[model samples]
Target: MLKAAGMLGAEMSTTRVLLALLLTSAGLRRSSQEEIAEQQDSSLITSLLETYSAVQMPNNGSMPLRVSILISVSNVMDVDILQYTISSVLMLNQSWYDYRLRWNETQYPHHSITVPLETVWTPSFSIREAHTVETKDLSPKVKLHSSGWVQHILGLRVDSNCNFELFRYPEDDTDCQLTFSSLLDTELAFEVSYVNEIENVKHEYLVTTLDARTSHGPGPPSFSLTLHLQHTPSKTVLSLIVPSFAVLIADVFGFMLPILGNERISYKVTLLLGYLVFHSSLVNGLPGSSSCNPLLIHLFLSILTLLFISMIETIFVTRIASEDLPSWMSRILWTHYTPGNQNTGDDGKRIEAEEDRVTEPRSAQEMEQRRQKLAAGLDRGFTIVYVSFLLLFYAGFAGTWFLMECHTEARPRPRPGF
Candidate 1:
């Protein structure tokens, strides 16, 4: 009877094991791919979006957003577009904090999640007076910090339709503004402040932040974040100023070439032509402004005029040297020094003077002598005049350049009036 009972117990255990295996296989088949996928979707949506985090405002009060910028200006385009990388961090009350508090969770399920804010309770910000902003980096990075501030890092290529003042061009220093203000808020809704930001900039452009000023008026109320950009004039001097001076000097020396042939004329003409070519390049490089005339423009125009006059004078004087002296030129040029005519009462002297008045309008040999005298006088006189003019012109040119530099530097300095 004991053996029979033990055999029945073993059979019962075997039957139970087979029944468990059958149940496990049936459960695996019932859990299909579509069912698993539906479960995941429902779980994520309920946890992240629909239940807690995606609301306009979890708390009732307005959130204060403080902004700071780390800009690395790579390329400033011709269209007044600043192609730059701006590492911008906006500090505010993190939205995730409210969600966590509501759910009573110790940790967020995911490390980070991106929330796209639309035109909702939170106000938007924009660069004041900016024409447009081109977003180069695809999407802004969103992260929640332990300190309870949401951090956002973004890269933007900003196109600001700025009006530039190039009064001191090439050696110009400018304060171009990259003002950030609330698009909808104005001063009433948000207090905008710039946290003195980090800058990784190019050597050619000395970028520094200027004093903040409010843009107060009827329009969308804004504030300015001025970027004081000082162009390092080192490259400008090398490419334009030094070359310009050098060309002017070469032109001046061209006048010294023996004016016997078209060699001098041809050389000077070519030199002038070269400078004209350089001028075109210069105009292209010059910064644009509403004001038409710049200091450099005035200076260059003066130089061009002087060169043209110098060339014309070269031709005129050389022509005089080659041709016969006109009666007017002969009369003015020949100054035979004489003691005031003494009343010697000598009849022979009186007769010789009378005969001089009656003589035919000088012989060819005598005319030739007068022409040579005129040419020699011209060489001496022109040398003095030309040298004096050149000295004055160059003095003015250099003085103007230095004066412009001084004005530009002084304008940016911390003065009481400013």
Candidate 2:
């Protein structure tokens, strides 16, 4: 029984030793595999770099390199109406194939590798209308796939020039474009794709449409991003048009006061002063452009002139009713009231007496009645003329506004593509 127990103990010890040996062998194999992978990765990287040249173009000079670009607009920073410029943030994803950077999948454990952007050849792009452009990389490194594809991402803050159409002003809509072109002399084919990922950007102008288009010419291949912006006229209408109309209505009703009193003249003068203030504010608030000025400016000026003319007419009528005119002026005004020469005989005396009575120095009541009648006739005629002018002016303005609206609606929009 002692011999059998010793034998069982020895058997247990051998089994334990074998298990330890197996574990050691498995660990060694795993460590070797890891080392091998590391060596292979290093070798692949070394080989790729040794053969690569960043200054050289990706493909042979015989054919143009085809590059695909994706543009994503992140935000619209500002739209300057005075400067006619637009500032925005854009993310560009540019991808191309480089045979020099390719590696066989079986030879390397990594299906993709990250390399510094400076170590790879990239196309240089510039904007045609941009006055200022700042570029930043999404990552310092670019991704290189085993199949020879490369992707680079960058962000740009661009301040580009835009032509603004302000004929309708507060009711205006404008189209702005950012054109990007390659600076390299080597022939290149560009495929542009666009997506708007804008978020949390608010302004008086809202982006109504976004489009991308490509153009090929003798100079270079170009891509354009078009942004259609619509102005929100609510603010302008409330601030400008409403107040202008109110002032105009008040001026029109000023005629209700009797023209013979200082109250009417003073009231008209006050309205004129108030309108001048409004006009000054309007001119100062609006952006000025030599090419195109808003129709609202002209409308304001016309209203101002009408108000001044109304005030002048009021003053003239007041003078006519309140003050006596000179003899020569009265004779010119009432031609039939002139006195004839005195006669020497009875018949002449009778004629002279009749002339004196007809052209007599009238009493206060009679003279006042005649003056009031003349002033009332002049005032009535002016009121008719003023009302007619206002009607014609407003009708013309409405017609112009309607035609502009129709024209804008009928204009064809550009189609987006590669």
Candidate 3:
């Protein structure tokens, strides 16, 4: 009975000591409220100075920091140097910096404290696939939350590389990728994870075809956020295709002009020159890549060839008109223009219907008939050849362009690299 009584007294004393320690700690915490609140305004210079001090413990990711990141893309810019520029804000929930300034939630009441990100423990992080430039904006102030969440609103316009194929350009869709990863922190020192399962983007211009976060690591871990942006090609279609078709229409109509004089040649030359100017301007605006055949480039070349051939044909036909043709050759070519037989109430212009020039006629009337027939035959032949060639060319070009656009092609993905 006495031994049992002693054991009970020892247990009661242990409970009393624990209660006293708790009360004392609480009192000390209350006394340090002002000091705790002051931690938010801690000088970055001071932090940097003390960063190298020995704490008798190594700090190279010894305690793996759990970093949950969320990205909200606000703007997507143009493609330059085969890269897509993006603007976004980041929210990072880091447990390392949160508890360092812990205090009563009711007193200071600031849930978020703004601080330079490097002052806190560095995570395994970087925007992978970002275009390397001389001046990168990495000094963003991450707002640290009392609950260990940090939010940073930065406009680091990242130009991520995207592959473009131009075989079916102006009617093709472009897919761009945006990947965020960390390279400095080993997987052991930092756990990089996404706050949201899917990437969040502003849906104004580009369509979000794929939004995913991926990580494959047991060693040096990396968190990747990949988003595929699909281009509708509206701008190119409206700017390039429409204007080019208009010029093509004008060129086609030039074939209708009577080829009696220099009108047809002048029209073709002017049309070809206009297209050359247009092509040069278009080339200046297009991405300077030769991955695939550009639609405009092909069409421009075809038009140039046709115009050159038209000029050659024009010169050939003019020479034929000026030169004399054989009486039989002219007769055969102008069979439709033959006069009906005279002495049967025929008009003065209609002398006689010679039976396909059975023998070469040397009469003055026959000579005049042959000369007139030659001019008409040459003009008519030029008209038929020009129209036929253009029509056939149009059909072939249309078929090839249609096939280029309709063929099944694998959607391009941005290749990940430095």
Candidate 4:
């Protein structure tokens, strides 16, 4: 019986030892987990930046740093044709990798960390054609991932110079560029991306296409964002083209009035004056460029010239009808009344009488009738010529305006050095 009690006591001692070992191991594990959590919360950032140098380029200047650029255009604020500038609201996202900033997630317990931009190295860049740049962020920061990736986001209101092809004017589609170039001497390989979040509304221009490309030349790398913008021509058409067409139609129909009365001449003079007002407005509405001017300007000027010529023709025809025919014209009209064959005798007398009958009218009523017939014939001939000229002129203008490519080839501007 004593031997059995001894074996039970030995088994109980073994059970106590096993339970004590398990409790000790559980406590140790809890302590270790708490220590790790504390390190992550407090020391992770300090450890990362303890040896980091913000000014040094990654990879010790051996290889070109690869930077991924994403430009999200939220709104096109304004496109100034006269000043040759475009203003935009843009969100710029730039990302790169730095091996020095990397850390083991198992130890750090952080997927990513937000750090002040002054804490790490970042790519420096500038807009080549920027006239004004405004930053929206009061305090800028960067996001560093545990996997060595760094992301920087910026909000900007930029007014950049744009070379616009205004040959087609209101119906034109122009290409404008926003060129971003690296200011750092350290070489950079760029991967460019573009996102156009513009909504189609009543804006002056619609961004029809977006293209992103990189330039790797003798100098630093540059990334260009080309926006293909189509103009909204409704307002121009209503204001300029419609009014010009109406004036031209009115001038064409003005020939229907009687040329014998003063009404037609006065009417044409009034139309010409009104057209001058419209022409002045047209000139003011379209902004001119040194490279190429809008064809619409020339078209309006040509219309003005035609209107002036038509008025002059009306005055000349009216004067011809009001007065008697000149001697030279009467000779032409009456071939038999030649003065070269006349002698001082009955033949001369008869020739003089024939000249009187040809040059002068018999009665006031007959004279008026003759004037009316001559004026009507001349006016009819002019009407035919004027209408025919207008038809041909408009046809040629339409063909040239629609079919011909008039825009100047865009040349690359010199990249400004930082």
Candidate 5:
């Protein structure tokens, strides 16, 4: 019985040790699996990070592998024209960011990316003549840069379809400019054409023009260009011709007013002069360019001609009034309603000599009446001319405006490739 109990205790000890060993082996296997899984997870995370890491930029001419963190410029402010904040990275080499990046992302990542950016300022661009804008003045507002800078590159796009002119001085030799506050895209170029946008602010871009306020500047006075994305290049001949015709009509009537010596001559001259001055101011408001905006030339010519005609007519009328008329009537002339035989003094002829006249001053009265009648007719003719000219002018204006409205039609378009 003792031997049996001893053997049983030994067996129990062996079994207990075996059971402990089995549990230990299982635990070790689980640990090994957990370690492998951790390694794989680590590798996956590293790959992801590396794949989407910050962009790389060429330094001057050399390529350096550096960590760059991209930070989306959430809201671009006015102060950013000078400088703005960038992402903080432990790496010193990654601190420098390049501004020449093309930002293309619907939802930019808020996190900082690891990429270098470059800022570059390009030279001024040349603006040619023959550019036409809806208005003479360009808006002062401009957008130098846009937000959502994902990688190191920030695309600077400048589009111009309005304000095709720059007012250059005689001494200025440099061309007009379109500059950015930050940097510019030297690889890219500029394009401009006629577009019909009412707002000059819609085409906000990073191009700059000369500011003529400076003394002896490089180019003419520069105005900010407003792009009209919604407008297209299309205009009617009538739109180009109507304003000119209106000015011409007003000019023609200006001549007749003074010619008739009408009392309202001053009023007519004033009205016509006002139109001429207003149109002149309007033309001068536009930028100076070699291109012929037909309307402008037409307005200038018409106004000048009208003024000339007015002055000439005034002189002519004055001369006419100063001229001497026949002595049949001194100031006024009246008709002598008498039988033919009444004046038959000697020769039985229905004639009366000056000496044999009735001496009633009828001839003078008649002459005066005739002169009054002529003056009245002249006044009436002037009035008619004035009214006719006005009607024609307004008619042309209305027609031109209507045609412009009809000609200006908007059509949808695909996005332009930058």
Candidate 6:
């Protein structure tokens, strides 16, 4: 029994020791497993910190954004819309980077981009308002610059709508002064087309630069204009020449009066003086030098010539009217003796008949009648000759003046330097 108990105690003590060692080993294994897990967690945390540090981001919480610019211009403003578009891009730093080029199949490389923009500026006004401008007027011009990218351009779109009134008749008291404001885009390429209802006209202009403002940077823009007058026929100094020549035609008609009377002589002299007055006045009004206007000089000389002819005719008519022929001479030419009527002019009988025979009273009457007819015929002949000369002079003078004017036009004139 004793031997059996001793063996049991030894087995129990060995089991107890084995149990303690097993507990110690199990505790060490658990602690080691916990440490390994902690190490793995630390390495993961370090990796996460490294990843966050690699990315650079602004911490102020502001969003990344680019600058956007806007530009616009009026289609019908007074300034040129074109000049503002001319620009050169300045590269601030070129040494740090190499440029990359992308091209299409056409072999055109993409060094620059041309942005196409669809923008329109149109004048907004009614036909009634435009027409109502009347003496008041509104004109606009447009210009554009072809050298800038459409997208990057920035400028103001100015729509300058204004009205001005001018007096149609110079005698009228109305006068107007106009002030033009700035244009839409001070810097851009633009063009202008305008409709003037009041003027019943259309205007177009290239907007170059502006005026009215005195400054330096991109000077003020302006709309220059040239007005075209219509071809409505007007009576100028040129058209008056024909009517002036007609005044002398009246003098020609006055010469047809009977030459045997004092009345006719006075009329002829009076008409000649009137022509002299008119001719002198005309010469004063005309240019002193030779003129391209043909009839001017010809009319001057022809009238003076006509005056001379008239004065001569007057002197001849006056002398003839005052003359008295001898009675014996006249009776001899006029007497027509019928066998019974040829009576003697004495106190009695044929003593008078001897005197009458020499006097020839019937012959005298016939001769006087013949003289009157000859005088009239001579007057008509003189008038026809005077008018013929006038027409011939006019034709020759016109041809010569025209040739001279054309000659002057053909040669080039030297430029004036001094």
Residue 291, candidate 3: how far off, in angstroms? 3.8
- Cα error of candidate 6 at position 235, Å: 4.7
Better of 1 and 3 by TM-score: 1
Highest-lDDT candidate: 4
- Tell me each candidate's TM-score: 0.62, 0.80, 0.60, 0.80, 0.35, 0.33
Task: Give one digit per residue, the lDDT tens place, for model 3 in 328-364.
Answer: 7556544644444234554433444444354235443
lDDT of 6 by residue, 230-276 (tens): 21113323444554566567667667655666666677677667667
lDDT agreement with native, every candidate:
0.54, 0.81, 0.55, 0.83, 0.36, 0.38
lDDT minimum window of 10 residues, candidate 1: 409-418
TM-score-wise, the better of 5 and 6 is 5
What would you estimate as the lDDT of candidate 3? Answer: 0.55
| lDDT of candidate 5 over 73-156, digit per residue (tens) | 111112110111111111011123234422323333222333212222212222221121121113311111223232222222
Could you tally the backbone clashes for each prediction? 0, 0, 1, 0, 38, 50
lDDT of 2 by residue, 1-418 (tens): 9999999999999999999999999999999999998898789888898878898888656878888999998888688877778898898899999888898887786899888888888888778778788776645678899999999887888887777777788999988888777766347888899898876445788877789988877777778899888898998999999988888888888888997769989999999999998899898877766656778888889889999999999998887788576776555545533334334688987886776655666533555666778888999999889989999999999888768542222122222221
- Number of clashes in model 5? 38
From the highest lDDT down, the ranking of the candidates is 4, 2, 3, 1, 6, 5
lDDT of 1: 0.54
